[model samples]
Target: MTANSLELNPVATIQSPFKSRFGIPRQSGLVPDAIGWIEPHAPWHRAEAWAGIEQYTHLWLIWQVHDRPHQPVSSVRPPRLGGNARLGVFATRSPARPNPLGLSLVRLLAMEHQAGQVRIRVGGLDLLDGTPIIDIKPHIAFTDCPPNSHSGFAQNEPERLRVDWSMLPHDEALRLNDHQRLVITQTLSLDPRPAFHDDPERVYGCPLFEFDVQFRVENGTLFVLGLNPFP
Candidate 1:
């Protein structure tokens, strides 16, 4: 390591229900009911490092795209445009970047310290399980949420599809609570499918908590096919 070239070490790792990248939301806070946590590593494991963090309502998580290798490229496709348009890497929030770093604003739910271990529970996890957390900062509304900001092509959040759970089978010991059900609903509404995929006949599965949610999209409405224990 050199003075000019900095190396980032993870302060913690995220514990999320999203076991894989296939069904995770493209962005955080999209599914407000989704719950996750951050477990501090050796150096940051002390409870003193997380003291008073509960006072804040939300926090900014600086993480990395550890699941995939970095693709060296100047331009990439934004999924919002159906993966048809190419833009500079910096212009889009794609994980295939020079550093593979990512930032997310998540709502803080609770903080717990048990036996010298500190765990911070959060909501709206778009990250995969065991993803490294580089840094954490409080979200300042005045600075983070600037007024009249122009987001170029992504001026607004993606459109949500209607989720239908009427077809989900009850024989599978369906024991999802209200929030868990809402998490599924909100997750599916964001339409996790790739922008290029438009096959209404195709079925997709997303693992949430302990169950695998199966579904398909037809006529703009997403239908819940069934649920199986995550394998």
Candidate 2:
């Protein structure tokens, strides 16, 4: 193993629906409909290397944190400041700096070419299931579109967390489908949690299959009372 000590592996591996990473939403297209897939590995699953990548709509993951745990930080303590502020891990994105490498842009919801393998069904992912794909650039809206990008020092922009679909459960609104009921009502109206972890007598829970919807967030909105569906 010496081609400069080769070992970069993961050509692809994210299949997210975010099975864990506790309430994911740390940033990444902010849940335009959190869904994911990208399983290319093995001879790069050639199909001419996924020619034209479906006329791009967005794609630029370069993931690899495989579940962190390699610590040796440069500075980090940003759970959006609930971790007691202490930035400087290249100004925060902190997966524990020095190369935990994770950058997303997502949203290209289709592309499968099995038989030589190649799948890619992304959508605003925040990465969490398997995560490993170490490169897949494409989002080039004119050199990474930045028509006035500047949020240095993280200028405040948090205010959206109101979701009350009449306290859900008219048979769970007939099992959603209008884009998953508008992405679960805009992901619980953006209260993905993390402003010092707001807690109005907390009660958040999220799992839906055998049911477990019990949410709560008062004032900033997000209240779905009823339906433990047996959990």
Q: What TM-score does prediction 1 earn?
A: 0.94
Residue-level lDDT of model 1, residues 85-164, one tens digit each, is 99999998888888889999899998888898788999988899999999999988778888888999988989999998
Point out the worst 10-residue segment of candidate 1 by lDDT.
169-178
**lDDT against the true structure, each candidate:** 0.88, 0.73
Tens digits of per-residue lDDT, candidate 2, 17-65, equal: 6655655667887778877678888777787888998999888988887
Off by over 4 Å in 2: 1-10, 13-34, 41-62, 65-73, 80-93, 102-113, 116-125, 128-162, 166-179, 182-186, 193-220, 223-231
The local lDDT score (0 to 100) that residue 88 gets in candidate 2 is 77
Residue runs of model 1 more than 4 Å from their true location after superposition: none
lDDT (Cα) of model 2: 0.73
